[model samples]
Target: MEVETENKYLEPLFQDGSLYQNELKCDISEKISDILTTITVFGSVSIETSQPAIIYKSKKKIQAQILSAIPHHPKSIDTISISLRSKLPFPAISQSSFRGFTVSPSGFIVLSDTSQRLGIMNSCGTYDFIKKGLNSYNDITFVDDITVAASTINAIEIINLDSKLTERVISFHGICYGIRYYNGKLLCSVISKGIQMIQLSNGQITDLVKQREPENWSYLAIHDDKVYQTTSNYFVRCYTMKGEMLWEHILQQSKGVARGITVDNNGIVYIAKYNGNSIALLSPDGQRCRHLQISDTKKPWGLHFNAITNSMTVGCVNGTIELYDISYSH
Candidate 1:
């Protein structure tokens, strides 16, 4: 776990000048017994209105959740969302220049910023403070119910949500971009060096997943026992959860950079990127299946997917939260 060299993350991958042929056994089975769902974010405008739209998918049914943040009447310091057309309203926190939002494995939402204070909110609108130490809020990822982390200039802050404790903070050679939590494991994006595995349970750090051939990832997502990421040049690369390269897919000549990613129960990956006025759906292995574009092209910054309703939660830089439909009938 102690990454000793600049190329440390790759050490365990090659033990003795030979490929670590330690064929990592895995449950890469695609037999998902759960319901099928998908979600994509996009911007769209009607002849009468120009607003961001949210896309969703679940059980072959699609629904939309509007992301427009309207005033909650009392004018409190807490940020909350009220659907102008929604019957069920909830309180949530919002911050400025913020691009990170994460849903804990326990269903709590953490919206954070290094420029501002970090906020934790639940579906009911209750907000709490986790910690404060980042110079700039790059991204937020949940490690578990008790632990959530954020990336700043040169380090990652691990916070304990239950006790409001910052357990540990660590830095590396490059800036951190995005992170994801799965089964208590973490995958962190190191701007120029690529992804690093920060083992939460064991307290270890593996730096250069694969030496010399890293995609220099910027965003991270884990599913189907593989790690999916958006690397430099808008390419999508898939690797084993522990940093093994299973496959790589690229969108050559695509309009913009791949920014964020989400996956559905059916094993499809959804992407939000720079040149996107819509959401791009890719195969589990990184192939572009199709793109669902919004009528408007407002820049989407943060996105979360709820597979149960196929609802895609989107946060745009233009100050809006919208939902979209991404379900396809089989």
Candidate 2:
């Protein structure tokens, strides 16, 4: 299930106020217009390991939502292995899974948020590139000009966007969760499997560090030879590149959750805490910056820092993206 849209003038529509959610399709240049989404879950959003939210910077605040539903009708696949449960066998009904977002270096942004609809968007408007028979890809990274990685549960795929195909780059035990490339190697986020580091030159995989104390995987970021990892509790742990736990910082005194993380050229870390409606900027030495704060009483999901302009971009769960200056004094 894929849907694509192509418009020659999405940018001007957003600029002229002719396309902010009402205009068929347009770029989200402001925080207030990322994506007007609706969420419906058959199960708990917290129970499952999901990447339902990701923050990125383009002309707009684009997003992807994960949905789960019971199949109305069952269909047989090419292969099926059944075992007895209690009174009968269980059937496998196919559903959908999504991966990380792809911010194109080529200035083309592709939105695969909902299955059956994949959007090729730019500042002007959008170009739809939806088709059937594509695998559910999770976690995307542009490795170089041609190579890209799409992570999923069973395999880590190196895909050629030019060819539009993927093959397993490596295999893992549990879900091959989130991944990011920093300083040449691929750092993978795992559920109960800790952080796995794979050298892209060769497919050699090794555990950089194992997650201790908690049974959940939230997010991971690498900067200044430190691996900043978070738990479901919004408790952040800064560990050495060797996986040594260095220090911990709690964004808020409460039991809230923090997901999105971005750092600026000044080594200031910004946190996006959902439902808390706050974005925090922390010094490289772990001190909170007094002036760099954005609070709206509604949880924010994504953030991006632009050093070129000395500003930060924020995305709210309530359908808005806002940019604020960190240079202002309190």
Q: Highest TM-score, which number?
A: 1
Each model's number of backbone clashes?
21, 22
List TM-score per model, in order.
0.63, 0.57
10 residues in a row with least lDDT, candidate 1: 80-89
Worst 10 residues of 2 by lDDT: 84-93
lDDT (tens digit, per residue) of candidate 1 on 1-330: 354462465444433433322333334324343324422323233333222232222321222233334433322111212122111112232433546777754456777653445667665555676656637667788776667787777777887777777788876666777788767656777765677777777757787374333333267777677777776646777777656787777764465556677776666776775556666667655544566555453666566666666566655555444555444532
lDDT of each: 0.60, 0.52
Give stretches of model 2 more than 4 Å off: 1-99, 102-120, 124-138, 213-217, 253-255, 287-299, 306-330
> lDDT: which candidate is best?
1
For candidate 1, report its TM-score. 0.63
